[model samples]
Structures are given as structure tokens and as C-alpha cells.
Target: MPLLRLLCATLLLAAAAHACRDGGTSGEPPPAGGGGGGGGDGGGDGGGGGGAPTTPGWIERARENFEGGALPASAFAPDPVPDDGPFSDGGAYFTSRGVTPPAAFRATQPFGKDGWLTVESYSRRGDARLADHAEVVADPAGGANHVLRLRSQQHTDGTVVRPTAPLPSRYRVSLRAGFPAFGDGEAGGNNGYDAGDETAGPWWPEERAASQNGFYWLTILDALPRPHNNTWIHHHRKVVIDSDNHHPAWMETWTGDEFVWSGEHPIMMIALDGSRPGDVKTGNAFFSWSNGAWQPSGAIRAVDAYLPDRWYRVTIERDGPRYTLEVSGTFRYGGEGTYRAEIDAAQRCVWHYPVDAAEAAGAAGCVDEGAFVEGHPRWPAGGAWPDWFMFGDPHVNYYEGEVYYDDVVLEVWRD
Candidate 1:
């Protein structure tokens, strides 16, 4: 089906979006949170003159804490869809959280009024499993305060927790997430994987390092704060499958990592009015990983360093032409502190209006190229392109780990 816009805070609907595949690999990456409150105006002293209506700083809002727990279990088996083959560096991770239909199609109200959330998952075999307790559990983090959890085992077998509704075009979202145990890539170093075997030559240098380091987008899409627009996520209704699989010729044959962003009535993020980003920097836009978490960057600044079990309160927002990223978590170095940066065009978050500034900049060292959208670019879907936020690994090849999520809030600036 399409990217449904069903925002019901109180009602419940059990459904799923099917991106059917017939096995084999190859493709590109695919990509909500919660609730509301009035701001700026506080309850002043009861004066003789009535105070003006307390205006909310945000024009629209949606949030999810998973406190009410999950809705009743609902199982879905998507009917087989046509095969369309692989997307750019595609690996078979297709997911959408809270995959409910539109208000007219299902019972829905404004976003976040619904205290419950829904989850849907798919494998490459055109088979789908929806609403399994093991996949999504509320309050698994050991608090009556509650939290949302998503876990994936297979390389390409992942799930998503869709929200009751969508966030506004221009919005600020905040959430807490944790990767309990990120595998250490250095086999012979410390942590005791091979113990004393200093010569661990199982994988290629790049593959070994990449495998040890969990990815922000290589697996999980839209888990943290990033810019979004009409070009949210584009999935094919009919997935293409190549009978004779072979490794692509690499950089010389590099056409684009976003080949899946094109072709036919693809599902997700495509506006009803027909708008797609000419550039491939919106969803799965690149960032640098350092000092544990994947720090926001203009160009690619990645070293396959390892990540241990840790938690952080992550906030990514777009205010006008500037993007702000703030992360705070307990670290081995200085315990807990906040690291924030407000990025603009000068930082090379993007090169030129066209993405040709230096396509092959990786030859030297990775340069800041792609960037997140500066503001909430409108999507005709009645909300953001996806109109949903995902909370688990959505890619098949790289990371297969658990992500703990809580207290998600999405907001639209009043301006």
C-alpha cells in the first residue's frame, strides 16, 4: 500500500506495508515518535484581566512513550509482490513503524492521542511477521516509566515500530536510544574474542572493521535525528530479483547508491503530488562516526572503531537554514556530558546545489558532502514523507543488533 497517514491517539488498527521480495540480495537503504503539551505561556498569577490564549511553540506535535504498552497482537502475511531487483548497495531491509492506513481507511484521530504503537517486519522471501512480542516489547528496560525495544537477528531480517501519526514538515524530535553491546572489530585486541590469537585473518581488513562497528544507516534508518523531506523512503511495489548474482564492479562501476530511489509506483515518501529529490542526500544521508556514537558530520569521517554497551539522549533538529545535533550519554572518559553542534551550508554538509562538488572526494580522505535537509520540506502525503519513525535495524547486510528506544517526541516549529 501507500505511506498511510492514520493518526489516532486513542483508536487502534492492526495492519502492515508489504515490500515483497523473492529471495537473493542487493538494494539501497530504506527509512516516529511521540506526544504533546503547550509551551511559552505559563499559568500566571490569577489576575483581574484574563490572560491571552497560551499559544504552543509548535504548530503540530506527535509523541510516543509506549507507556500504555502495545496494542493486541496482530499477525500479517503480505501477499506476494512483483520482484524489482536491488537498489543502491541494497541489502533487503524494508520496514515501517506503526504501519496503519489513512483515517478514512481506518479509525484515526490526530497523532499521538493513541497511547499504543504497532510493529511490522519482513524477510527477503516475500514473507512478513507482524506484532510479535519478541520483536517489540514495552517496558523491557525495567521501568514503569516504559520504553520501546526492537531486535533483529538475521542479516536482513529486521522490524520497525510505526507511530499512530506523522510529524509536521518542519519539526524537532528528541529520543533516547542505546546499543547495549556493540561488537569489537579488533579480534586480537583486548575484549577476549580470540583471546591470544593476534593473527585473526578471517575477513578482509575493511570488512572486519566494518563488521565490528555497528552502523547508523548501514542497518538502522531514521533511528536518530536527521533532515527529512518528500524524498523520505522509496520502495518498489514489485521487487526485482537477479537470477545470477555477482558482486558489482566497485567504484569504476559506481552509478549511485540510490538506484532504488527511482522507478515505478514505489512505496513510501513519494508525494501524492509527485516530488522526488534529484539528489540522494536526504534519507540515509552520510555522517561521521567517532568517540563511540555516530556523530553528525557534513562529509564522511568514519573509522570502523568499535562501540561498547552505552546509552545517549539524542536530539537532531532543523531550525530554518541551520541544523542542530546534541548528544549526551555516559562515557568511559568523562562520565556524562552533552556534545552539540549547529551546522549550516558553510560546513560542506553539502557541496553545491548540484551534488557534483567532488563526487570522488573519498580518494583522498572522506570529505563532507551530503547533508540533511535544512527545514521540513513539505511532502504532499499530508505530513512528512514517511510520516513515520523507525526504531530498529532496517538493512540486511551490516548490523544485526538490538536498539532500545524511549521518550520520543516530534515537533513542528510555529515560526
Candidate 2:
């Protein structure tokens, strides 16, 4: 297990019991407030102008606040999206204050016009449980600097409240999140965890059954700020999984931690071994993750593989099993001929819960990595992969463990 350490260049140790306050882990320092805002014009398909509100439908322009040298008011230029409304993160973007999505922002699916993005103070999985609450506050011009805030037992048992919607290809996303009670990673010295990464893979450790932490939160995928900087498209979301699992206790970092300049498809995922379940997604190929193993994505000249979590980037572009897997932007694995055209790339696939090993084994033969292989001591699916599993430990104060997630972008063409 990794030894728990504090952030910055400071060292302050305390007992796990009294180390944190009610909202965060014990012994952690409070996060510093007051950040600076930058100056930039808004950018996006949706653009317009600002002045005194004359029409009834058009929303009123917003005023800027520059307490500690932030952006000035004139920076709030108006640019209406073509038929598209104002961009938004989740529901209420700000937690410290009662904020709402700009009038231009509206729901696209489920119930359009009806408020789709919302915020709350708490949530639960089963019965009457008090989890933390969160909200999102969008910037006036639909630019960056969107904020999020949440607190309480919401940190335990996979209790989460997030907004889901279709997204664009180019944009920048950022957030300012913190825990009031604990410093950062000080609650479950031996057992807390949280993370924000791609929504693909088993929820537990590389090998484990349930979550050691009680709760978790993160913005999976979001839009980039404007002024149309190509770099905004590639910046990935940050994932944190806090738990009271391993001995010494620590936190997990995912692929989205790095800031990219541009790319397609933005997605994020968080998990709890026992409290939450498993999830996966693939396209133009088939994939299976059970029995602690890794398998190729398709059957044609195309390819399939898990993108690397650390420094390397993995991409599998193929029409069938006869595909290629590139690591660190270089070709690491793939096939030339053999059964190339037999496998056609798939569109979509997902595994939720109540799925069994036999069902997992029956899904596909593509996942055969060490973690999902047979005879692996920690393979929770028993010799096969199940869609979902449980999360959380009642007796433990925090669910703690390590989680690694990486995001991969695929660009495929057939032969």
C-alpha cells in the first residue's frame, strides 16, 4: 500500500479519527479560496451580443466581478448559439451561492425545455441516506471558469449527482472542487478513494470486490471555454476517488489529468468496488472484461486494447480483428492478415449489474488481461466478467483504494 502523504511541500500528520472535520478527512488543511479570472472573448457555435435587454425572450447581459483582479464587466460580450442554447456544465454550476444555468441553456433530450441540469445538497443509493449535494454554475458568455461545490457523506458509497447530455468536439473544461472537513487525502488513512476518468472498466481495484470508501464525485466530460483555442478540445476532465481502503490510504489519478489541445469524444468515469458497479464502452469492435484478462476489440484488420493509464496513449483503429493497437502514439500491437475482415467494428456495449461470470465469459473473448484472467485471486467475477458489483464497507469509516483510468480516442478506416 502507498504511504499517505499531504499535498504541496508540507507535512502534517494526525490520527485518522480526529484528523478531519465533518466534510473532509481529518488533519487536512482547508483549500485556499479566491482565484483569478482571465480576459478573453467567448467562442462557440452559439454567439450573439449584449446591451440593455429590449426583447422579452433574450436574456439580460451579466455583470462581471473583479474582486482580486478578475475579468472586467465589458468582457461579458453576448454571442447567441445558432438554435443551440447557452452551454452549461451540470445544473446549478456554483455551490457557494444559489446559481442557475443561464436562460439560454436548456435540456436537449428526455424532457427538453424542462430544467435538465439540477443541484442538490445530498443524495443516497438505497433508502434514507444523506449523501453530499453539488451544483454547476455556467459563465455568462458560456466560456470557462465554470465552478462546482459539494459536501458531506456524499463522499461515501458511490452516491453521486451529475448531468448527462450530448457534447461537441472542441471545447475546454475546468473545475474548482474541495472538501471542507479533510485536507484532501486525510480521511480514511487506510481506506478512502475517489476518481474521475473514462467510464470504462470494472469499478474495483485492478483486483478487488468492493469499495473501501463511502462516497465519491467528479465531472465526467464537459465543454471547453471559448475564444476557440484548439487546445481547449484536448484538455481532459480530472477524476478523484477518495476511500478508506488500503493501509496508509491515498487517492487515484486518471488519464483526464493531462490537458490536451484538441480531440474528439470526451468521457469520464468513477467507481466503488462494493458500493458501485462496473461499466465499459466500445465502437467498431467487440470487447469483454471478465476473468482478469484483456482481449482484442474486433476480428478484422482493425484492433482493440486498453489505452495506457500512465504516460502512454493507446488507440485501436480497425474494421475487424486484423487491426492495430498503438501505444504512446506508436504501434505496439495489431494484426496484418489472418482473420482480418471477419470482425466488424461494433457500435456500442455496456455491462451494468446482476451479470454473471458465465454471462461475462459468454459476452466475448477479447478481455484476457492479468486482472481479469482465470485463477487470479482478486477477480471478483469469479472466472468470468459480470456487468456490475456492490460497493462500500459499513464498519470502516472510509472506503479506501487505488484506481487508474485512461481515455483513448479512436479514428478508424477499413481496408
| Top candidate (TM-score) | 1
> Mind giving the per-residue lDDT tens digits that candidate 2 earns over 8-73?
223443444344545455455545432222222211122223443333222111111111221111
Residue 384 of model 2: what lDDT? 34
Q: Which stretches of candidate 2 lie over 4 Å from their true place?
A: 1-132, 135-148, 154-161, 169-171, 179-246, 249-415
TM-scores, in order shown? 0.48, 0.25
Specify the highest-lDDT model's number. Answer: 1
Model 1 scores worst on lDDT over the 10 consecutive residues at 237-246
Per-residue alpha-carbon lDDT of model 1 for 1-415, expressed as tens digits?
1334444421233222122243212263322111222322111122123454545465435566656555445444432321222121211111122222111100111223443334545443333433331333644445456565555443334454544444333456667766533233332332212222222111111232122313231111222211111122222110000000012211011012212211111101101111222343233233333333333433322221112445566665555424455556664333466645444422332221111223223212223222222232312122211223444443333334455677766667653
Evaluate model 1: give its TM-score: 0.48
